[model samples]
Target: MAIMAGPGDPVLAETAAERIRELMDGGFVVDADGQHAPVHADDLAVISPHVEQASAIAARLADVPGVLIGTANHMHGLEREAVVVIHPLVGYREAPACATGLGRLCVALSRHRAYATVIVDADADLVLAHAQREAPRDARLATQRHVLAALLALG
Candidate 1:
């Protein structure tokens, strides 16, 4: 699976790592190395646009047992069954270009065949709007409310 931490939100990545570790402990197998085996440190990939953020997340997840840290470039040609994208919303008035770029990145990242793509961001509404606009017809939208409700139920 792939997890994309925000440009400056290392905590989000750390939390995700914790959740992933918990899931792993509960028998969630990720990228079984083509043998349906258990996940190893090399199976999970953490991606971010900023090298520093990516590196930080990598370091935080270093002891997770089998997770790997990498830049967004690593996603090319690879298939991830699950992905978590942590995007920070840039106000359009502050920097339209940057906002557009991040939105494009989010859309591109969501195009993969991952069974689940969890995007955590304060501006999730904007991100989801952009993603839905560019998503394929088969894609379905899952709002944060729905996700939170599910998590609550599980709890």
Candidate 2:
């Protein structure tokens, strides 16, 4: 599922942290290695494309014991029962190549076993639209822009 944190919203990482806290309230169960069980702190992960963003989310989640938080690259081979991904374009007016890469987005979204929540800025599509004005020259970015657009549309 996706949630939009608009330009006027709280810091993106804070918004994600709030959602994570709420998810931990109770009664949530997830499949772990094919067995169903109540979700634990250790079963949750918070992922972002940037290290600083991950670190900021980690600071806010310090009170929530055992949750793994890290950049998408840092989490490449890991999986969790649930994941909250802070969309890299959340605070940007234009898309950054580093964040718009298809691989990074895929890694961030695919690391979940049962549930996934992506927190994106409401204006992300606009940002990508602005970036698209010059995207055709770069085929890879053009492709990524299409994928990002589809993800936003899914929300």
Candidate 3:
């Protein structure tokens, strides 16, 4: 997908942008500010927190559908366009960010009527069958909030 890693970080943004542009047959040529987008992903830092920037990139990136992924070393806010932020632990002390875990993530994407399911991928299907079971909505969300609180405490 097309990308513009937030401000100050240009490396990742440039590489991701270049790859996406190549995949897009070179249609991606503009940045959030209407300038020529970077040529590689390593040219990124933290993408601007402006929705316009996101919209610009999303427009080009949407060519690849069903691709739900994002990355962060230590996420501090709602990472736009990401259904999941892979942090060792998420922290939300002042706000109830993970009061709904994946549900909240779905809600943030405007899809709230969701079911909470945790899946474990491995070679043994039978062993992971039960491991992939769904959790009660409220309970799962509570667990997420609790985990976030714990992370905040540890930090």
Candidate 4:
């Protein structure tokens, strides 16, 4: 599920941390050999595009045992029962090249084995649209925009 926050929202890390706690407390379930099983805190991961945000999330979740917290890059090739991704461009008016890269978002969203939650800015579509309009010929940005659009549409 996608959680939309206001632009320049400074609490995504905190929100992610809280979500992990909720999932843990609420007995997050996962498919285990076609059977349902409760997920442990260690089975969850929180990923962000920025290290600063990652660090903040880690700090908040430090007491929660077994929850992995790191940047999207760190999550590559890893899988968890649940994952919460902090949108890279959540607070940006313009999409930065690094954040708009497809690999990062793909990794963050795909790392989850069962459940995935994305925390994005409420106006992410608008920001991406403006970025795409500004660089219509940029194939990479267009692809990223399309991918994000598809993701958002799922909700």
All candidates: TM-score: 0.53, 0.82, 0.21, 0.87
lDDT for each residue of candidate 2 in 1-155, tens digit (9 for 90 to 100): 23343332347778778878877875367443666566689889999877777778888999988999998899989998889988767777767777678788889989998888888766677777778777657765677667667777787
- Per-residue CA lDDT of model 3 for 1-155, tens digit only, reads 11123221333333333444453353223556877642332222222222343344444456555332232212234232212111211111122332234543333333111211111112223222222343334454454445444433543
Per-model root-mean-square deviation over C-alphas: 7.9, 3.6, 14.7, 2.9
Better of 2 and 4 by lDDT: 4
Question: Model 1 over residues 1-155: C-alpha lDDT tens digits?
Answer: 22243346556556656655654565345343654555444445554555565577767776675554544555555544444443333211122234335434554355334433343444545554555455534133334224433533543
Ranking by TM-score: 4, 2, 1, 3
Better of 1 and 2 by lDDT: 2
**1-155: candidate 4 lDDT, tens digit per residue:** 23344332447877898889888878657464677666788889998888878887888888887898898888879998889988777877678887788788888889988788888766667778888888889888788777778778976
Clashes of 4: 1
Tell me the TM-score of model 3: 0.21
Question: Which 10-residue window in model 3 sums to the lowest lDDT?
Answer: 112-121
